[model samples]
Target: DLDLSGTVGAMLRSTGGTSAPIFGFGIVDTATDVKVTLNDTNAFMVKGSVTEADLGFDNFRFGIDDNAPRMIFEDFGGTTWQLDSNGNNFRFFQAGSVKMQLASDGDLSLENNNLDNVGVIFLKQQASADADVPAYGQIWTKTATPNQLWFTPDGGVDTQLDHTGAFPTTWSDTGITGAELETLSDTSDADSLHSHSNHGASHGNTLDEAYDEGGAGAGRTITVDDGSPIELIAAGPTTKVIDILQSGGGFPELQLRPDGILFGPGGGTPQDISLTRSGNNVLALGASDKLTLDKIGATTGDVLAVQSTLKLAKPLVLDKGTSANIDGNDEISIPVVTWLYLTSAGATDNLDGIGAGTEGQVVFLTVVAGKDITLVHNGTVTAGKKLMINGEATVTLDQDHDFAIAIYDATATVWNVLVPGSGGGVGNHNILDGSVHQDSVADGVTAGSVIIGNDTPKWDELVISIPGANILNVLGIANGETVPSWKSVLDGTNPAATAATASPGTSLISAHRDHVHPIGVGTTRGDILIWNSTPVASRLVAKTAGAYVGGDGTDVVSTIPKRTIVLTAAGGKEATTAGCAAAAVVEAGTNDVDYWVLDFDKDTDEFAFWNIVMPGNYDGGTITFRVYWTAASGSGTVVWNLKGRSYADSAAIDQAYTDVGETSTDTLITAGDVHISPESAVVTLNGSPAGGEYVQIKVNRDISEDTLTADARLLAIEIEYTTDAISDAI
Candidate 1:
């Protein structure tokens, strides 16, 4: 080995030829084996005594291929050092260190960087596929547009997802607004799962806060928004339902079942409810169970009531009307809550048994007028055996009408009359007899004061122990005693009393004593007894004299004034004609049929009669009448044939018409002595008409006699007469 201290450089050139030196530093003997090695300076150092430099052996090197350096090492024993393969690749390995590797394809890697299996932090290339790349944990798209950090799952592909909304690492649509997302930054970790500095107060998995029973976290609620549907699916049959349980007690408040939901009072067994979807998706209840809808706050013992008024569209009738006659044997059946009105057309009817019915069945019976309806149950008034009233069945409602309202009880089988007793009477006290009574007065009688009889008696009787004032007994007259007269009870006038058996005086001087006489004179019988100033005592008087001297001392001398009786055509009369058939008389008739007598068929219109009487002491006189017996202006040739007659029986006198006068057919009777003569002989008058004389002045209208205009009406009648009697003959 040779060593150089200074720069002594010499180059030995090789001869130009095909043969050249194989190495710069080489062993000449090619067959000899050589070894070159590097060692530390402490052992392989050369130390010289004459002016030598310190030698430090640090790095080694080698060259290949045209004398280019192949591998090199630098800075031995320093912090900054490196081993370079000089544009080649190399690898280093140990059991538990980071594997430093290099590939022949010019790629480098450090294996096992304290990450999970196949999970890596990688960088993707821009615009090219990253083949066989790690896809888990953190990644960088540094060479791509808008540089971003990507978190991918294992075996990541270009399955892109956006996390700008709702949740990070979750799928979301692009262009989402911020309001749709939860803030997940460290400044405001308002999301379901986030991390912050306050680890003690913060939830690790903020989306779920679990709690045990009786713990602080119990009763905490997790609310799901409507935008998200919560679905709890069982992994297998082992986990089938979701239960909402009562806090602390562990009782299930509600259980969502695969079939239905059960929710109610939650003690032993929460109300079991199930919905069954049958064919056609119909929901049906289980057999033997009813859907009971109850009012709120209703107790188990209370009855269910309707919330509003209940009106029935039809009448609630009980048992149908009995078609069969009501016999006393068969019991009639009835239903509850109805009116059973049974009308019996039979002459008589009786009620026996009322058939079975529910409680509150009303049965009404209506009986026609004059019907006999008797209740014959005759049961005593017991709890369930009696009807309306005890023994009321014995009362026969046979009078006129009867009606009853009865109710029935199913258990009792009895018809109890709600409205008892029958009404309808004429209210006749005579028929009521002793059945009716009233509170009595002081006496034993039930009505009226003791001192009086009937309030307004039709006939009254007076019984007296002593006669009252102004009362006299005519039977008390003795043999020689005088009898009291009307003057005894009157004031300012007294008549001389006469014996009870005194006969009428024969002489006029003696008869004038107790009789009323006229002031001037009287000579006829039936002369009215009146107060006379000349002879004071009661006196006999002649009627003509009494009437002439009137009691007022005025000379009335004329007879009774004639009274014209105007009888309308409707006055009472017997006519041979059924109805009047005259033209002129019909025009003047009160009604169409009320003309006095019509002469259409003269035999049919023969006679019209009036039975009347005149006052006594009246001499026979002429009788005038309304006569429609002749033409209004005519001669005797065309006369209305009618006659007038006055009769006082057979033994007395009668005036008769013997001629048919010329002017007999006046419509309005105006003539005085135009005689409508009877068809007999004429007579003259002598004496006054007597008492007890009923004269019938009749008109005989004979339309058969003459044909002019005999349709006559006797509208009125007038009697003109005079009084004739001896003035002083009494």
Candidate 2:
């Protein structure tokens, strides 16, 4: 081997010439392009001084094959170097392994998942990029919002690099790293121990300068933009899910993952958030969402909320959802997050339950006037639709002006009423901010609605002004004390009752509760009247005693005046066997006219019991029932004994009957004749009978005292009791 420079010595003979050069065969080219060719299985090589040296010797070779060209350099050592041009691509090989490739389409590919060996050096560009795109734009597009770095920028206005962008090598080969990214920096030194001329300070990957306070690289903000979501996975390498954990110190962290956005308190217990969709949940059973439906097994749609309160600002409005009876039943339903615009029908409308309710949900309900809706506490309104209001059953939304509030309980799966609904627009006011007049009281103020001074949390005094100051003077009153009278206002010496004569009052008087005006009108004698429907404009009906105010079933209630009510024996239950009074029927002609009766055997002395709820209108007194029965065959005097007990709410249901019953003797005048017995003396109830309480009355016949040989077919019994109202409060 000879090393010669600046000398025309012959080492290679020109293949294009017929003759060789003297001294040494060499080829020289004066043309603009020159070519070197080696046939197959031949190589232009350089080797150590060894005879007949093969590829195993320390040598380097520039070889050619069928449409392939490669240059290999080896020193009898491992993984030297090789550059090959085959498959129309440029590849660098180390130890016969492809380390990097420059594709024909101008892409530089590194075959690794990490750039750990790469160092922060001068950025370079790929000139083969598409003409319209920026240099290295093909790879930079992956990072839509590229990261910025200050690897080793020279400070000053005339610095070569702007230091506005960075070259950050990620864990994937598709990401470009060595690109000459633009960056902005005052001073930076890329060397491990060198100082920058601009700042005279050293900064590198060393621990001493890594987190220097107030340094360019210290406490800098890193912006992670939203593109194809950035995911925070495990510290180790894996595409599968593995929890990113803290040291169990209970630090809060939010992370993006395959499942969804997860939030973990600490110790690796990350929770996925569930977002709501418009349609009903169609998630599979045991899926993260729709877990509430899986829990309660309810087919009705509901909202599952994990938070406590849903607050809204003032003037808050919502789409009014509808609520009505379910298929003519007493049950109803309205989605959780909504206000109810309710409509109802029925003489005694009942709202026993609400459906489609979720745990920790609140509901508001309203009813119009005359639409009586009673929410029964512990009512029998089927499963998945149950409620309890104040532990009592009188929760009725009686008016339209009022609304009810309720909360749902998952464990009990029932709505617990917070504010009981009172139908008919007659409940506590839903107060809002407003002003009320506090001026001196006037005469005309007693007619229409007005605001007045009252105390509230936000105001000193403000409330609804009830026009009732002088209501008694103008209110319809009967002749005696019922309606207003001219004598009430005219005072003494006022003329007697005359149809249309007016006797004006001598002096004015301040209105008082008992101040009845002596007007020139009269009314009927009965309990005060109550409106059955919304009052018509200026429609004045004279006060009548026929209709009294009552909140029970929809019916015009009236004062009994006689203090007596009659009930037949058919409404009572019979005892068993010897003491049981059985029901018997009688058929007359061929058409079979049917008539029902209670037959008490003369030999057994059977008894019939009547379970009664003393009407709300019942005035408390001794309740006496007479047995109306008939003789089927033989007849004699019949002795009927009455005994019973009353059981109020919470009273012992099995209380014993009265010690001694009142006995009445009635003799049968003729066979098959209806006999009347004297009213038995008032029999005392064991539980101290009272109005609106439950009473069980048992009537029996004494066989020893009665000579009736045949069965006594009892027709009916008349119960005598007094009522002070139309009916019990509904």
- Against the unseen true structure, what C-alpha lDDT does each candidate score? 0.38, 0.51
| Tens digits of lDDT, candidate 2, 250-361 | 5554444454445556444554333434533222333233322322212444344435354433344455565654436677754544567456666457777787466677
Off by over 4 Å in 2: 1-215, 222-253, 256-260, 265-325, 344-348, 356-360, 368-372, 395-400, 409-413, 418-730
**TM-score of every model versus the real structure:** 0.18, 0.25
lDDT of 2: 0.51
RMSD (CA, Å), candidate 2 to true, equals 28.2
For model 1, residues 1-730, the per-residue Cα lDDT tens digits are 2322233222222223313321112122234312222222222222222111122223333334244333333343532222234345665444324256676774666676553466665655454224434433334353334444433333332322224434443221111122222232331222342211111211111212223212453324434554443344443442325445464334445655554466545542565343435523234455554444332232432232344465544454344343334433523434222334343557666555555544655556654456666555544322233355343433345543355666766566677763344443213333213232121122232342112222332112222233345433222333454431111222223344543233574321112234552343444566554433442424444454424443324532224443334433344355445544332343433444523332333345454455555555544554344442322232332223323334555745444444442224432233211334222222222233343355544444445444433333344433334444433121
TM for candidate 2 is 0.25
Q: Residue 50 in candidate 1 has what lDDT?
A: 18
Q: How accurate is candidate 1 locally (lDDT)?
A: 0.38
Candidate 1 wrongly placed segments (more than 4 Å):
1-330, 343-346, 356-363, 367-372, 377-386, 390-402, 408-414, 418-730
On a 0 to 100 scale, what is the lDDT of residue 261 in model 1?
Answer: 63
